[model samples]
Target: MTRYYRVLSSIIVFTMMGIGSFVLSKSFAEDEQNRKGQPIKSREQQESKASNNDLAKFMRGKLDASSQILDGLCTEDFRKIISGASKLQELSAAESWRVSTDVMYRQHSAELRGAVKDLLNAASKKNLDGAALAWTRTTLSCIECHKWVRATLISKG
Candidate 1:
C-alpha cells in the first residue's frame, strides 16, 4: 500500500507539471506571435528624446469621436487591426443583409481606403464635401480604436 501511494503521488505530480508546462509553452508562443506582428515604431529613437516614464505604447479603438486626435500611425494600428487579404475576404464574404451601413463595420475601413484613393485620383477636381466626409470617417476609425484600446493614455501635459 505504501509503494502504491508513492507511485500514485509521483504520477499526479508529473502530470500536473506536464500540464503546467504545456500551458506555459502555449502562452509563450502567443506572446512571441503578438510581438512578431506588432509594428516597432520607426521614429522611436528620435522619440526617446522625451524619456518620460509615463508614456504608454498601446492605443485602443472605440474612443468617443470627440476625443483628441492621434498623430503618426492611425489609431486602428494599435488595435492590431490590419487590412490583409484574409480580412478583406472576411468582410466581403458575408451576406449583404447581415452587414450594416455603420462606420464601425470592418468593410467601412476598406471603403474608407477606397474613398481616399478616389479622392486622390480627383485631387485637382476635389469635392470638398466628399473629401471632408471621407476625412471624418477615417478620423472616426481612429477615435473608435482609441476608445476601446487607449486606456494607457499617457500625457505629460
Candidate 2:
C-alpha cells in the first residue's frame, strides 16, 4: 500500500507541474504576440487627432464666410460685407482657428484678421474703394498662408 501511495503522489505532482508549465508558456506567448502587434497610441495622441479634425471643420466654415465677403462686394451690399467681415474677425480669434506653433503662421493669421477688420471698418463708413482694397489684401494673405502651409507639409513628409 505504501508503494502504491508514493507512485500516486508522484503522478499527481508531475501532472500539476505539467499543467502549470502549459499555462505559463501560453501566457508568455500571448505577451509576446501583444508586443509584436501594432503599437497602441497614447491617449493624448488620439485626443489631439480629434481636436485637429474639429479645427479643420471650423476652418472650412471660416473659409466659406471669407468668400462671402467677395460676394458681398460683387453685390455692393454693405450689410453683407459687414456680416462677412465680422464672421472672419470672430473666426480669427477662435481657438479652433489656431492650430500652429509657427511664428509665420501666426503672422499670416494676424494679417488676415487685420485685413478683415479693415474691410469691416470700410463697410461701416460706406467706403467701397477702401473695402475693395481690404478685400484684395485679405485674399492675398489667404493665398500666401495656404501656399506656405502646403510647402511646409510637403517638406515634412
Please state every model's RMSD to the true fold in angstroms. 17.1, 12.0
Q: Name the weakest run of 10 consecutive residues (lDDT summed) in model 1.
A: 57-66
Instruction: Tell me the deviation in Å of residue 147 in model 2.
Output: 1.2
Q: Model 1 off-target regions past 4 Å? A: 1-115, 122-124, 151-157
Give per-residue lDDT, candidate 2, residue 14.
100
**Which tens-of-lDDT digit does each residue in 1-157 have in candidate 2?**
9999999999999999999999999999989989897467899888877887887888787788877888889989999989989988988888766667699989999999899889999999999999999999998998998898888854784
Tens digits of lDDT, candidate 1, 18-64: 99999999999999988887555667754763443212211121222
| C-alpha lDDT score of every prediction, in listed order | 0.44, 0.88
TM-score of 2: 0.65
